[model samples]
Target chain A: MKLQRVLQYAKTLLSESIDAGDIAIDATAGNGHDTLFLTELVGEKGHVYAFDIQQQAIESTENRLKENGVSHLATVILDGHEHISQHVQQQIGGAIFNLGYLPGANHHVVTKSNTTIEAIEQLLQLLKIGGIIVLVIYHGHEGGKEERDELLKFVSSLPQKYVHVLRYEFLNQKNDPPFIVALEKVKNFPKE
Target chain B: MKLQRVLQYAKTLLSESIDAGDIAIDATAGNGHDTLFLTELVGEKGHVYAFDIQQQAIESTENRLKENGVSHLATVILDGHEHISQHVQQQIGGAIFNLGYLPGANHHVVTKSNTTIEAIEQLLQLLKIGGIIVLVIYHGHEGGKEERDELLKFVSSLPQKYVHVLRYEFLNQKNDPPFIVALEKVKNFPKE
Candidate 1:
């Protein structure tokens, strides 16, 4: 059997963690690819919150969802995902974050470490037990290494009692291939 | 769905790579658990070679295979895995190495970097196209950290054109939980 690539494994994780009628989130909503994926996973009974900071991304995701006739299942929000706790208050079964910039768009507006960590913290709080948060980290561009390093440091510090943080990476590849950092909630919220 | 632990993922990978009549190897047949597992995976039609440096390990594995009534399908060897090139000269479908000391045995007798890397090189040579070699690295014991570091370095430097080196690790766990390093042979051989 062929080993799944980064994106394929990411989708596999989401598919395994999410079921029909379960709430999901596309934290990046880049090109609307993952948003559309989440919509199908949650189905009509479930709902998806698609977040993006750029108007272009929001428009792209909205158009993709509309074209797929799945607009009703997902909310395309033109806001940073760090504010997800504001838009989505209920527990979610799964979420995905594609770090770095929107493909074929401005590379300057990449996902930074601080906001990304904040979004992760909020999502972890809102995640159901046994739920997963999949981060497809793309760190091939300028200032990308810093973000990747910071994100790795932050995730490594997460307490193991409540969550299991897994890092899936290809070591021999060139061109800084994207890697996956998946966090599975093993318990409820962290104890105060 | 709950994420698979290290051992489960290792078996899943082996099962996916090995066919019913394929040749397989247990590079470190510690207590023979993985050896027995591989025997089932390869089935009665296939063959397995299990190797260990310790006499006790070899005896235990031999007994387990005998008790399980599959002793005829596997050959137990009381030799270091670094000598794989001498005993096995055929292309293999898959192999597994459980690094570190044997469980419930002397923790000081752990696998080291030089011999581990040598065995990996030999296995890669003997692995058929699309075959895989899975390494379950347990690095919490004394002298284990150095071996882990060296092994990671060696695997990372493998040419991407011929091999795909993947590191599957858990970041948040307090203890150094065993992680998986899976190498898939994508090409016949690396160019000199």
Candidate 2:
């Protein structure tokens, strides 16, 4: 299978639950690929809240959405995903996070562990039952390792009564091929 | 998604490569679930080499296959999979291993890391190009953790040029849910 197989698999998983008019989030709108995918999945009535700290990334995503004529379905935000709770009040149907620095942008400005964990926490609270959060982890660059390690730790600690977290990664690949970490909120999740 | 979603996902991945009338193996025929699955996938012309250390498992698998009217396509062996190379000399298209003791059987008799790893090594040699090995790891019982740890280490060390190892595991699950580790041989594998 190709390296892109995991992404395809992620889309399949999301498509199983998400339908037209559902609300989705692009936790990291790098290059707008995921944002565009979400827009198409959510259709016209649905809304997508996309977050990116880089202005260039937000602009690029906005342009890509406009090009695809799906801009109406998305709200592009030039802010950290850690602040997701402040912007999104609707129950989320699904969310996607492509973790790492924006490609072709300043590599120094990266997604940190604290913010990622916080964003995930907020997303979990706002997630509808059976909703999923997909994380594509790219940990080959500087600071990437730390983010991956911390995220895995945090994800592993999530209570099972609420959600199921899945980690899909290639074990034998070199240069740290990107992996996917997904969380699907359980049906009839117990109240904490 | 249900708890069996990962298993279904594993079947999907295997179906991508395996075709009718192809040789396959069930390294651990626990209750004949995978054995039956492989038998159907391989069809009437293809053969399936099924191994289980427990006679009960072999008998169960044999009975299940007979009930399904596909017993002719399978050879049930009441032996460990570590000796798979000795019985089967032909190249294998795909293999499945449900690690841990057979459910409802004697839970003490478990698939240890040493023999499990040995079977995997042999299978790697026998796997045809584009063939896959699907491992459903049940690492919650006694000796399960060690096997999981050692197997992860072993799989992580496999050369990327030869095979791609994919791990699918849930992070937030009580009682340690089973995970899948798959290895797909590369089409243009380098000659060792």
Identify the candidate with maximal TM-score: 1
How well is each residue in A48-113 modelled by candidate 1, as lDDT tens digits?
A: 999999999999999999999988999989989999999999989999999999988998999999
* Model 1 per-residue lDDT tens digits across residues B1-192: 378888899998999899998899999998999999999988988999999999989999999999999999999998999999899998899999999999888888889899999999999999989999999999998988999999999999999888999999999887788999999999878456
Q: How many residue pairs in model 2 have overlapping backbones?
A: 0
Off by over 4 Å in 2: A2-4, A188-192, B2-4, B188-192
RMSD (Å) per prediction: 1.3, 2.5
lDDT at residue A60 of model 1 (Cα atoms): 93
Separate DockQ for every predicted complex: 0.76, 0.61
| lDDT of candidate 2 over B101-161, digit per residue (tens) | 8889889999999999999989888888888899999998998999999999999998887
Q: Alpha-carbon interface RMSD of model 2?
A: 2.6
Q: Look at candidate 1 and tell me the lDDT of residue A93.
A: 95
